[model samples]
Target: MSVDVTWLGHSTVTVDVRDTTGDTGGDPAGRLRIVTDPVLRAGLAHLRRRPRTPDPSASAGCDLALVSHLHHDHLDLPSLRRLRPAVLVTPPGASDWVRWRLRLPATRVLEVAVGGTAELELAGGAVRVSALPAHHAGHRTGSGLSRAPRDARAVEHLVRVPGAFPARAETDLLLWAVGDTGEFEASDAVLDAAGRAPDVALVPVGGWGHTLGPHHLDPRQAAELVARVRPVHSVPVHWGTLHPVALSRTMGDRFVDPGPRFVEHARRLGVPGAVHLPVGGRLTLDGTGQGTR
Candidate 1:
């Protein structure tokens, strides 16, 4: 089996799973495509795309999309509209916000809590996605305190209700996309939930501002995270991609340095499989669990 990951920019990535074993007798080209935290527009919110990165629209046509949180950049409505993934996964209590924001009447939204799993079967293979604990706040603008009573009540009830997930099923690929979070102490909880370290970890190493915010991981923290979880291969996301256009002239290297810095830090921390994927770059994992750029 092999999984291919394309880092579009920032937290957006396209993960394609293929059955390379030859035993499944599936279409060699048939793969389940999943995009995480997709932001498929040139400019989103206050930040503008960095020059020279691939077009953000390259993330379109995903089999599914996972929104880790409600942050503007992560759950971009315009971007989501472009992809129109068949299934959309969000954290608990977020369906109302997503629906209201996107007006996605036909799209199916799956509300998953920490440890919940959602499985999707596609043409050539199947994928199992687990919602692990992210050490971050879940608030989004125009949500919660700002929503009217009806919507607020719905969100509260959905959040309080327990998450329902399927029994852990066998899958061709298993990925843990740690959306946007700092290092956490509840790693055991994550392991217990997934039952194993992810085959590949798409971790956030930087953000739009000069200073990292609460619950966001900088390059060093991202390296430490890889050391702890020890995925077969880890790729840095949420860095060297989007930045405030006005600051680009003044802060030349700041927007494009974290990914390389993270590669060095992961090596220093003894994470044997840290891979730095530049914008539009791709990484592939093979049957023996080795990764190639």
Candidate 2:
């Protein structure tokens, strides 16, 4: 058994869990694909995707899609339409927005609040996704002072695949995505949400603009989170993806420096498993908690 992760760009990632031990009738390999916070387009507002745009095939055939908040960058409707996942999990108050924007039926869209869990049954095994607390603002306009929806809030997600490791039947493969959060003391709560230490963690290292607010984590702070969670493997995200069109030349370093800077800080803190994955890079994690790029 192994899990393959591909960082498409920004916060979007595709996690494929393969169960080689099971008998997948029509679907050989018994693979389940899950995508997170997909922003597939080349441009959004004043921001433009640097280097290149994401390939549509990267998010193709996704079983489930997870939306962290109501922010436009995290929950792009056009990108969601491209994937057309069988199930879409979003924050508590954003169900209606998803339904209205994507015209998806109520049966396909699920709203999971903090501490709430949603289970999905696959051909190979079962998956449990739990919503955790996030410190970032959740308004669509990116401002708390604006007239935002009362129930809108940001959340992190914990994805657990039962029996993913063939060697250890009692241990499950846990992947925690700390979506758009700041430096906070939620280590205990995050550990409790996953029921144990995470096998893999996808952490945000930077934001889109020149300045990151107090709600966002910088490179050093991201490394601190990795030290606390202590996952078997950690991948840095939310950097080196988008930037303002005018500042693409002036702020080039800001768009491309966080990932490497995080690796540096993680090494100083004696944090193992801090891997920096470039855009469209793929990493494979085997049953023994080892990874190959």
Candidate 3:
């Protein structure tokens, strides 16, 4: 179980997981690539990506892409097109929006409900991703109101395709990617679905705005989440990346402040380990799976 996790920017993370044990199903070169909430484009409308952020192409080549909600930053169409994950997982209602409105025709978008599992059989072994319930609002179009495309059958041709992952090698990596969820109910659903704690928990500690609004977690609340779920290792995300184009000068530091604040809270709470990665920082866990800070 060797896992390499890199925070590309914002909620986007690239996890390269490999199994070192003999149980690699006879394939040793297998790698499971998982990415979450990819907002790869350098600019989003009026909101410009700050300095030192990875380019859109940095998110390319993932076996599976997970979307926690339908917000513009989290589910950007152009970003997804650039990343081109073999399999895309979203909340139950978002698949249609992504398929037609977002214009993703070829990608296999599987809308998974809370407690439902999207199982992937790789050359190494099986990878199970459970879509846990999220507390945030799922509907966010440029206009507040936008209906699904009239032709439901337009995307019927690309429903399920096998052979997404390459033939490779073994070990298990359970990742609970909780994106921008503020409520405990969402976490409880994740815990209920995950029989054991996740190897790494990618939690959102803050957003770009000066204020932390409803269905969002600030540094302290996010610390509470880490204390409750208690994963082997926790990485703070959704901060230090995108910012509103017209924020007040006084609150500008909010963008770069949350990650370290969350780490401090996690320490005070006595959590196992906290990897407060910079915008492009990375962390690795070897086969032994020790929580090294």
Best by TM-score: 2
The residue pairs that clash in candidate 2, if any, are none
How far off is model 3, as Cα RMSD?
A: 6.2
Rate residue 31 of model 1 by lDDT: 51
Per-candidate TM-score against the hidden true structure? 0.83, 0.92, 0.82
C-alpha positional error of residue 75 in candidate 1 after TM-score superposition, expressed in Å: 0.5
Misplaced by over 4 Å in model 2 are 21-30, 142-150
The ten-residue window of minimal lDDT in model 3 covers 152-161
Per-candidate local distance difference test: 0.68, 0.82, 0.68
| Per-residue alpha-carbon lDDT of candidate 2 for residues 1-293, written as tens digits (9 for 90 to 100) | 78888899999989888766666564422478889998999987678888577777777777878999988789887889988987899887888777877889998898888999988775446788899988888768743553346568899999988766767654688889877998767744678887677988889999888888789988999898888877778899988888888777877688778999998999999988888888989889777556898
Off by over 4 Å in 3: 19-30, 102-107, 122-125, 143-171, 248-250, 291-293
lDDT of 3 at 143: 39
Q: For residue 104, what is the lDDT in candidate 2? A: 93
lDDT of 3: 0.68
Q: Which 10-residue span in candidate 1 carries the lowest summed lDDT? A: 154-163
lDDT per residue as tens, model 3, 1-293? 56678898888988766555446453222456778888876777656677565755455557778877767778777788877777787766668777776566644777766556666664334566666666776666553355633221100000111222123122345576777767655455555565556668888898877677887888889888888878778899988777777653545778677888998999999996777998777787766565433
For model 3, what is the error of residue 51's alpha carbon versus the real structure, in angstroms, after optimal superposition?
A: 3.0
Q: How does candidate 1 score on lDDT?
A: 0.68
